[model samples]
Target: MQKLIFSFLMALASLSAPLQASEPASTHANITQEVNDWLNTSLSNSPGAFSFELRPIVSRLKLDGCTQREISLPQGNRLVGNTMLRVKCIEGANWMFNLPVKISIQVQYAVAARPLAANQEISTGDIAMQQGDLATLPGSVILDPATAIGRALNSPVAAGQTLRQEQLRTAMAISQNQKVKIIFRQDGIEISNEGIAMNAAAEGQPVRVRLDKGKTITGTAQLGGIVDVGP
Candidate 1:
């Protein structure tokens, strides 16, 4: 999962030169420190707070420790709950083994404060903040309430349901037949005019409008029903 991949990348920074095969392999205490160090370093950028526990290696298993080796995790899976890391020796004895790690990440995500109907515009009161583990929730859960505000839902959301980006629709900044302010700038000269939108458009999307003079122009849509044209 993401946590393991991140730790593996940071592991590159702490890698040391291979020691002689006769040299004693890394101890459990050493691994605990190294693993925890990288795990803390890389996960600091995560959107939520996290805690992890490194499972103890069996004393009976005489597998070579990673003094100079690569640690990787299975792909196409999120890094949470119970997971195993593959540690392969690149120097000394040719050996490989698996180490178990458990991760828990708690994030503050947005959820519906009340039952919301489809296409209903979202307001501050419509969403409430909830704290829970990321693994138990939808991957695309919205973490910011500002992201949901002013947007309409694609389907009805039950109260207490976690909000996701895919379930919401972005509010259009332009609408057909609506009067939109148009701005034009060329050769350092700027002018403003008004026009009727020929088609609906979202912010930053192209829009066509008919001016007072019966001339049509294409421009980039802006918020507040404004459009920018001419360079």
Candidate 2:
């Protein structure tokens, strides 16, 4: 009877030994498995369409200020045949805790972004324009910032570019004093007159020329205010 009781006790201990030995490792494995599942699901099932860019396997991970743990196979666990997928879990916190967590991962992806072109004419909205009566100003177009009005959107206008109203505006024409010669012809005599410029002119413009001798002549010429005439 004594020998039989001792044998039964030994058998119980033998069974208990394996469980004790595996308890810690099994707990860790559970945690690892759980986390792995979370990641896999996010990669496959999420409606946001996530992609798994597998990075180099990190050897260890820490959770919530805890010591980092390594993932490995169970000691007595063995596979019958060779398999491509090797799933391992870490031993942690008493229970077989396997849970996956999302981590910030860096990946390379292609995206479309706007780029400024060379020689593109910039629009008025692109620049700041002052609000005031432009006619009252010396020039037709008065820029609010002054510097922003006329600027190149891109370097030079490309060959196939269509000019847009936003990209361009009528430049303010300025007036300046100029000297012009006034000629008077009476019968067979010709008289020449010279005077200071009164105002600025535009290209292909016509202006009235006033002579010093109280005479005025109306003529059309390329307007630049400054004109050349013979002696």
Candidate 3:
């Protein structure tokens, strides 16, 4: 009696071993085949030229970190992998489709913040306008060149248009300088300061001088060289 009972128990144990071991592999194989079939069907039925690619499906399986592979559907098309297949059509297709998309994504968790939330975009720049006094702040997004110039006096600045600091400073300085007439007399020849000097003078160089409305008179003078005229 004891020997017969032992033999029966051993046979039961042997039967249970194969069933347990085969469960997971059978499940995985079934899932893989189903997904492949669904994708193949969708690709064939797609209207016009269509493309698709497999994306890694990331989700928790039971208590373990499971990698569920999926495809990143082109355009707004809907596609999902579950026991029951999910599919839907989209307005237009933009990206191409690739196959199998070997599932390699690890399950991730959401903590303090949802790290997987849609990406946040950064703004480049904006335009604004000012309406009040020159001292008051402008209330518009589009910025004017004049206002920008005032703010950029001492700092490095880049704007919608490229203006060289050296060139701009030179032009502004020339605009601010007082108009003066330069005149020179060499023997019988008489020449005005404007005729003699194409560029503004150095601090100590002597340039022929005359007032804009005055006579042609030769004087030792400097160009941009500041001179205290009149007592």
Candidate 4:
């Protein structure tokens, strides 16, 4: 009878040991989920639509039950592109770990709607909008159709080619030898004169103008063939 009692007690202890070991595993899963939730909430306000990829923690950690977790980014780190996040347990266990993250955003940019020849003036019908992963495209991609419209292309672009700011030039807003109104404003006083543009220039760009009596002056080109001269 004594031997049977001892055997029964040993079996009970062995069965209960596994149950105690399972608690840490469950806590670790909860910790991982907490970290994930924190990251999603933190980046909810980022520009454009984004998706996140989190690296799994392979090493086993013996951490106590954490009452609070603090998530932070490294100094000078942006939420875009590939970055790292620091997860620290502010309450209970005093431990920290780094998580590798890859952030991808969907971006809409302008592209050539059809094959365009060199020196061709770009119009509203010449461009189209395209959506793609920003990380995979060039850094100089043009995001707005308005920016590309009315610009002259410097090189031939294939159909569906992404438009870049460097690939286009501003269309001439003022033509050479055109009659223009030259205005000068200083100390709340306004002066106006008639002048002929000496060179073609884009809007908001500098243009040389020939005023009456063969006087020449440089001024900024404005809309409606107007030039602004500083006193």
Compare the candidates by lDDT and give the number of the best one: 4
lDDT of 3 by residue, 82-155 (tens): 11233221222222223334211121111111111111211122122223221121223222334323211222
Task: Write the residue-wise lDDT of candidate 4 on 1-231 in tens digits.
Answer: 999999999999999998666534226667678768877887787546889888876567666656777878988776667888888888766788887888788889889899999978899999999888777778788887898878988899999999999999987778899999999999999999999999999899999999789989999999789999887
Rank all candidate structures by their lDDT, best first, as comma-separated numbers. 4, 1, 2, 3
For residues 1-231, could you state the per-residue lDDT of candidate 1 as single tens digits?
Answer: 999999998777556433334457667666566667766875688788898888876777665544476666657545666677766777765777778888888999999999999978899999999999887888799998998899888899999999999999876789899999999989999899999999988788899999877999999999999999967
lDDT of each: 0.82, 0.40, 0.34, 0.84
Using TM-score, rank the candidates from best to worst. Answer: 1, 4, 3, 2
Clashes of each: 1, 23, 18, 0
Q: Estimate each model's TM-score.
A: 0.73, 0.22, 0.24, 0.64
Q: Which consecutive 10 residues in model 4 have the weakest lDDT in total?
A: 20-29
Ranking 2 against 3 by lDDT, winner: 2
* lDDT measured at residue 35 in model 3 versus the true structure, 0 to 100: 62
Clashing pairs in 1: 1-79
Q: Which of the predicted structures, 1 or 4, would earn the higher TM-score when compared with the native?
A: 1
lDDT, candidate 3, residue 56? 35
RMSD of 3: 22.0
